[model samples]
Target: MSEQWVETTLGEVADWSAGGTPKATNRSFYDGGDVPWAIISDIQNGPLRETAKCITPAGLDAIGGAKKVVPEGAVLVSMYGSVGRSAIARTPMATNQAIARGVVGTQVSPEYLFLWINAHEGQLDQMARGATQRNINKQIITAFPIVLPPAPVQERIVEIIGAVDDHIAALDAEVGALQGVYRAATSLLWGTAEGDEAAPQLLGNVMHLDVVRTPMEAGTTYRLAGVLNAGKGLVDKDEFDGADTEYAAMNILRENQVVMRKLTAWEGPITVVPAGFDGFVASNEFPTFTLADDIAPGWMKHVCRTPRLWAEMQSRVVGTVQRRKRLNPDQLLLVALPVPSRREQEQAAEALDAIEGQVAVIRAEATRLRKARAGLLSGLLDRTIDIESAELEV
Candidate 1:
C-alpha cells in the first residue's frame, strides 16, 4: 500500500471524455470500413466482439474535438438511458456520447478501476440527474470522489478477481455454444432456418393454455403474475406482501405451465411459472398454462415466441389509444405445431434443457465473478487491508 492514503477524483486517474455522434447527413461514411463504430447497442450483446456500425477515416475528422477512440484496454461505461454499465474495450474503437470514456492513470491499474466502478454501480445510478433520459456527463464521472490504494495492493486484488473472470468467461463460451445448438434444432423444425419455408402458424395449436380464474387469500393473489425484470419463473413473496389484495383474485399457476401477460405497459408475451408456485394465484392480467406430456415445454415456449406468432398476435391488437392486444383462446388452441416423434421431442427437450442449464451456470459464475471483483475493489480502494506486498489482477 502507498505509505500514505490518498483521495482523488476519477479525472485524475486518466483522461475522462465524452463522445458525439457523427453526422448522419453524409451517407458515404457508414459503409465498408475496417474501423468499428460502437454505440449504446454494442453492450447489449454482452462483451462486444465487433460493432454493428463502422465509420470511415473521414468520420474521425467530422467529430474532431468530441472525444476520440480510447486504447483497447481502457474502460467504457454507459451513462445514458441506463447508467453504470461498464465494459473493457476489446479493440481500439470510437464510442457514442451515451458512454463516458475513462482513461485510468499509472497510479491505478485499468482493470482495477473497472472493478471499482462496478462496485459503485448503484452510486452511478444514484449520481445521475436526469429523469427522462438518465445520464452522467463526463464532469459527473470525472469529478466523482474515489479512494486510492498502493499500486501493489491494487495489482493483487485484480489478479485474484481476474482469475475468476477468466474462468467465468470460459464457461460463458461453452454455454453460448450449447444455446446455439438448441437454436439450430428449433430452426430446422420451425422453418426459422435460412432457405426454409416462411410459414408462420398461429400460436394456439402448438400447446395448451389455461388462464387461472381462482381467488387468492384475503382478496390478494400471488405475485407470480408472470411479470418482473427476471420474468415470472421465480416468486418473491415479499413483493406481494403489501400489494392490494383486491387484484389478487385469479387462478392458481401450476408446474410446466406457460404464463403470459395479457396486458402490460411493456411488451412481453410469455413466461414460465416455476413448479414451486404450483397452487399460487395470479392477477387477472396473467394467462397460465400446462404443457401436454407429449410436448416439451421448452420447445413449446419457443414456438409461442417465434416471429410468426408475434406477427399474428399483433393483428389481434384492439382498443384505440390504449391499444390492448388480447390473446384469443380459440385461436391459440388452433396454432399448428411442428409434430416430431415423441422420442425426438424428448431428446430435443433434454438437449435444450442441458444447454440451458449450462447457460444458467455460466451466467451464475459471471455474476459471482462480478461480485468478487466488486468486493476486492471495495476492500482495496478503501484501504481496508494494509499493503506491504500484495497480489491483485488487472
Candidate 2:
C-alpha cells in the first residue's frame, strides 16, 4: 500500500441503498407502460436506462415506495449472481434489492468511482461475506474505503479518462452504420432476379447440383452457445457447459448445415456449422436446420446474421421468461432467402469479410481503450499521481 493508500469502509463517503420489486399479483401494475423498470441484470454497462419490460406508475408504487429510483450516472454495484460488477447508471432507472446504489462523496467522482469499483470488483466482493449469496450492505459500502486524491486532482483524472470513453462510444455507432451499408450492397448483388428474364429455379427443385452447402451434423445437435459473435458471423465451436452438461439426447452433427440459436439467451446467433466441430452437439433449447448446398455457406452466413432476418424472428417466438423466445423452425424455413450463384456469392463474401475485418479492428481498439481507462482510474484513486503532479492545459 502506498502512503496515500488508506484502508477504510465505504459508508463514510457515500449513501448506500438497496431496491425492491413491486407486487407480482397486481396485473394492473405492468403493461407496456412508460416507467422503465431496471432489474439487477440490467445494470450491465452502468446505471440502468431502458429496460426490456416497462412498468406503470402504479407498478412503481406497489413495491412500497421502492420508487426512490437510481439516478442517471449514479454508481450501481451488483451484489448477486454476477457479483461485484460495477457501473455508473447511464440513464435514470430503478433496480431490485440485489444491487447497491452508491452516491459518492465530494472527494470522489462518479466516473472515477465507477472505474475504481470496476477495477477493484474483487476487492469489493470481500465486503460481501454471506454463504448462499454474497451480499454487500450499506454498512459494508460506507465503511469500505480506498485512498483518495484531492477533489481537483480527482476531477482532472476523470477528465482524462472520460475522453477515451467518448471516442469508444462514437466508434461503436460508426460500426453499426457500416453494417447497414453492407446489407444494402449485398441485397443489390444477390437478392432477386428481375422479371424472371431467365428462369429462376427453386433451391429444392435442383437437388443434384455440386455447389450446394451443408453443416457437419446438421439437425441432430442442440446449440447452447457459441453461435454468433456479432459481426464475427458464427462463433467458432467451443464447449459452453456452464449450467452443467452432458445431455442424454446428443443431436448428431452434419456438414454444410445452418444452426440458429432458438432460446433468446443465444438468440440472434447463427453459424454455418464448420467441419472443425464435426460432431459437436448442443443443448435441447437450440434448434438446427439445413441450408441447401446451392446457396453458398459464406453468403448464407452473411444474410442470416443481418438485422432483416433476425428481427423477423421476434413474432415467431413464444414465452415470458427473460430468455423466453423460441424460434419457429417451420416459420424460419418459409422465409424467402436471397440466393446468389456460386460465383456471385464468392464475390459477396469477399466484400463482407473485409468489412468484418474493419469492424474487428475498431472493436479491439475500443476494448483496449476501455481497459486503459480502467488502469488510469486505479492509479488516480490509489494516489500514485498527486493532483499537483498532473498538469492540465485547460
Candidate 3:
C-alpha cells in the first residue's frame, strides 16, 4: 500500500441509506408519472440514466420516511438479489429497498467508491446473510473496509477508468445502430406487402430439418455450443461439462446449418452456425436445419430470428404452459415464408453479412478494452501502479 493512503470504513467517508417500494395495487401512484424509480435490475455497473418503472409524487410519499430520493451523482449498490452491483445516479431518482445509496463526502469520489465496491463484489456476496435469498443490510455496507486515497488521486483514478468505459459505450452504440439498419433492410427485402407479386411458399419447400446425431466418443473432447436469443449468435456451452451424459445422444452441428432451441423458438433463439463452430454438438432441444438450393443460408437465419416468424412459431407451440411449450420439426416445416428470387436473397444476405462483420469487429475490440481496463483497475486500486503513471497512459 502507498504510504500516503489511509485505511478507513466506508461509513467514515460516506453517508449511507437504503430505499423502499410503494404499494403496487395503487394505480394512481404510477399512472402517467415522470419520476425515475430505480430497482435492483436498473443498476448496470454504470451511471443510471433511466429505469424500467416510474412512480408519481404520491407514490414517493407512500414509501414514507423509509425511502429517500437520491440526488444525481450518488452511488447505489444492490443489497439483495444481485448483491454488490453498483451504479451512479445520473438524475434524481428513487430506488427500491434492495438498493443502498452512498453519498460520498469530500474525502471520496462516487465513481471511485463504485469501482471499489465492484472490485470486492465476491466479498460482498459472502457478507450477505439469509437462508433462502442472501441479502446485505445498511450496517454491512457502512462498516465495509476501504482503502482511502486522497480526493485528487481518487478523481484521477476515475478519469483513467472512465476514458476506457466511454470508448466501450461508443462502440456499443455503434453496434446497436448497425443492427437497426440490418433489421430494417431485412424487413424490406423479406416482408410480404399487400401489392407484392411473389407467391408465399411453405418453409418445408426451401429447407429440410437435419436430424443427424453423432454419439460422443469415449475420452474424446468436444466443443459444445448453443444459440442465443435475439440473434446474439452462438455461445460456447462449456458450463454444462457435467452434462456429458446428456450429450451422448447430441446432434452434430454443421457449418451453414440453422439451429433453434425448440422450447425457446418463441423467444427467437435461432442462428446459422458459422464455420468456426462446425463439429459442435447440441442436444435434441436444439434442432438444426439445412437450406435448399433456392435459399441463402444467412437470409434464412435472419428470417428465423424475425419477430413475425417467432410469433408464428409460438402459435405452433403444443403445451399448456410456457415452460412446457415446444416447437416440433413438423410444426416448424409447415410455417409459411416469403420467398424472393435467389439473386435478391443473395444481395440481402450480403448486406446483412457486412453489418454483422462490423459488429463482430467492434465487439472484439470492446473485449480487449475491458481486459485492459480490468488490469489497470486492479493495479491502480491496489496501489501497485502509481496515479501519475496511469494518468499519463490515459
Candidate 4:
C-alpha cells in the first residue's frame, strides 16, 4: 500500500441507504408515472440515463416517500441477484429494495466509488450467501472495504479509466452502426423483389430434413450442441456420458446444415451449423436440414438469422397450448422464401459476410480493451503503477 493512501470502509466516506419497491397490485403507483424506477437490470457499467420501468409520485409514497429516491449522480449498487453490479444515476431515480444508493462525501468521487464497486464485483458475489438467489445487504455494502488515494489521485485514476471506457463506447457505437447497415442490406436483398430475379419457392423444395442418428455407446462421452434462441447460432453444451442417457441414439450435426429447436422455432431458435460444430450431437427436438445444391450455404445461414423467416415459421406453429406449440418438419417445409439467382446469392452473402467479419473483429478488440482496463485499474488502486506518470492511451 502507498504510504499516502488511506484504507477505509465505504460507510466512512458515503451515506448509504437501501431503496424500496412500491406495491405491485396498485395501479396508481405505477400507471402513467414519470419517475424513473430502477431495478437490477438497469445497472449498466456507466451512468443510467433511463430505466425499464417507471413509477408515479404515489408510487414514491407507497415506498416510503422522498427518502427512497436518490438524486442524480448518486452511486447505486445491487445487493441481490447481481451482487455488486453498480451504476451512477444520470438523472434522479428511485431503486427497488434490491439496490443500495450511496451519496458520496468529499473524501471520494462518485465515479471512484462506482469503479471500486465494479472492480470488486466478483469479491462481493463471493460474500453473498444463498443457493438459489445469492444476495448481500445494506450493512455489507456500507462496511465494504475500499482503498482511497488522495482526492486528486482519485480523479486522475477516474480520468485514465474513463478514457478507455470512452474508446470502448465509441467502438460499440460503431458496431451498432455496422449492424444497421447489415440489416439494411439484408432487407434490400431478401425482402425486395428487385434484388431477386427468380420467383419465391417453398422451403420444402429447397431443403429437406436429414436426421443422422448415431447410436450412443456405453462409456463414450459426447459433446452436445444446442441452438441458441434469437438466432445467436449454436453453443457447445455440457459433455455427457452415453451411459447416463436413456436415448439409444442422438442426431449428429454437420457443417452447413440448418438446425432448429422445434418447440421455439417461432422465437427464432434456429441456425446453420458452423465448421467447428460439425460432428456435434443434438436431440431430436433440434431437427437438422440439408439445403438443395443450388442454395449457397452462406446465403442460407443469413436466411436463418432473418426475423421475417422466423415469423413465417411462427405462423405454422401448432398446438393446443401456446408454449407447447411446435413447428414440425412437414410444416417448416411449407414456408416460402425468395430464391435469388445463385450468382446473386453468392454476391449478397459475400457483402453481408464481410460486414459480419468486421463486427467480429471489432467485438474481439473491445473485449481485449476491457481486459486491459481491468488490469490498469487493479494496478492503479494497488499502487503497482502510478497513474500520474503512466501514459493513459488504451
Q: Pick the TM-score winner.
A: 4
- Better lDDT candidate (1, 4): 4
lDDT of 1 at 197: 44
Tens-place lDDT per residue, model 1, 1-394, is 3265468878887555422224445433334454565655564413345544655556654544343344445566655664444333322234222212333322366666666766676777778877666677778788877666667656766676666667768877777887677667555444322435435443454456676575445534345444542232444454354245655456667777877655632344655665666776666666666766666665654555445545545555444655465655554455444555445555555655676677788788778777765665566566674333325233
Q: Specify the poorest-scoring 10-residue window by lDDT in model 4.
A: 91-100
| Candidate 1 to native Cα RMSD, angstroms | 6.6
**Each model's C-alpha lDDT?**
0.56, 0.55, 0.72, 0.75
* Ranked candidates (lDDT, high to low): 4, 3, 1, 2
Q: Highest lDDT, which number?
A: 4
For residues 194-309, what per-residue lDDT tens digits would candidate 4 score against the true structure?
64445789989988999999989988999899998777799999889998888889999999998999996799898889999999998889899998998888988888878878
TM-score of each: 0.65, 0.65, 0.79, 0.88
Clashing pairs in 4: none
lDDT of 2 by residue, 25-116 (tens): 54333344456555656667554545457655665556552333444345666445444443334333232222123433323466656656
Residue 91, model 4: Cα distance from true site in angstroms: 6.1
Query: In candidate 3, where is summed lDDT lowest over 10 consecutive residues?
Result: 91-100
Pick by lDDT: 2 or 4, better one: 4
Residues 1-394 of candidate 3: C-alpha lDDT, one tens digit per residue: 3448889988888766322234445433333555555665576666764545765556555653344445435667655564333333332324322222333322367678778877776777777777556577778878888998888788888899989889989988998998898777776556434436356788889889987887766666777898898756799876334335655678878998888888867787888888888988888998888988878887776776678788888888888888878889889889987788877777667777788899899999988988898889989989888778888888
